[model samples]
Target: MKPLYNFILSAIGATLLSGCASSPDHATAGHDAAAIMPASGGPLLPLPGESLVPAHDPDDGLFMDALSSWLEQNNAPPNTQYEFTRIDLDNDGRREGLVLMQSPHQAWCMEYGCSLFLFRAHDDGFSYLSEISPVRGPLVVAESQTSGWRDLIIHVSGRQNNDARNVALKFNGRGYPSQPASAPGLAMNMLDVTGVKIFP
Candidate 1:
């Protein structure tokens, strides 16, 4: 009886120690997940009135209503199609905004193809930057390490049949892309000039 009691106590002690050891690991795993998950259920921008062909059919009326309310409040103007492509460009957990507009002047340039606009959610509100025209399949952000600085790269492509072009826009301390020192030496490509700092 005495030996049996000792064995039971030993087993209980081992279980407790194992649980203590795993507690920290479990906590750390949770922290990592939280850091990677985008913020959900925030106040989204309102949808415009003329009604958008829902990115998904059988639209959720509640979402549409909230979107409509946002559009009216922001005065987004007529004939602008706002598409929220939830992409986390900056890796900030919160998804950034991708707006596609089909204005007559702008629309004509694309010839009915969609124009891509990226917006970063700022403390005050959403800030719209340049129209991203890809030289390849799609314009994507690339980062690289140079001699003594890091570069924020943007690739812009021309029309469908054109070879994919490259534009290396550098960024500095505050995280904005710097202007190209010289011409990209490529024709029919747009460079980022949004005053984003560029590192040498």
Candidate 2:
């Protein structure tokens, strides 16, 4: 309730007590992107056992199960083809999964764009994180972080692929914005980012 001197003192105390703080749940103890990046940092890299082979693997029980659920929930065709990209967003050993349905029947896509699904890796399999829809690619992974997660920059094509605008989706301790049009507008040159192709 104190928004002045007490806040300043609290901030100072926070800095001092940061070392003793615990990491975000289901995430990290303390993960710095620099700590995981290669000496000569290049693009985002997937940590060990985090790569998605064949992009869409039918044998991947976890992924298949999640996709099925998503499709059923949306009343989409169960056989909708999808492409996936795996990258370590939180600098954790496990890479987060980004998926886009792009094939035969694009029931999930609209005039604005297609939907993207986010998932986190677990020892058992991929767990659903969130669903960001009506966004187009190429998506960019930003150097900036929020709530210990990397920010996302994606193209949001206004009606009929016209009036296009790129938006920034910062993780709000739980997930990114489900509707990107309401998210903050982002200029291409405003931040350091790695452009990623998720639809190809």
Q: Highest lDDT: give the candidate number.
A: 2
Q: Mind giving the per-residue lDDT tens digits that candidate 2 earns over 98-200? A: 7665544346677767777787655445556778887676777776788888888877665544756777899987677888887766766523556443342
Worst 10 residues of 1 by lDDT: 1-10
Error of 1 at 16 (Å): 45
Q: What ranges in model 1 sit over 4 Å off?
A: 1-77, 103-115, 122-125, 129-137, 143-164, 168-200
- TM-score, structure 2 vs. true: 0.60
CA error at residue 191 for candidate 1, angstroms? 21
For candidate 1, lDDT tens digit of each residue in 1-200? 00111000001111111122112111110113332111122222223231333232212222223233333344433443433333334533333444333333353125324444444433223443334432122333343433323333444444356634555544333333422222153332334432222111
RMSD, every candidate, angstroms:
22.8, 15.9
Clash statistics: count for each candidate: 17, 0
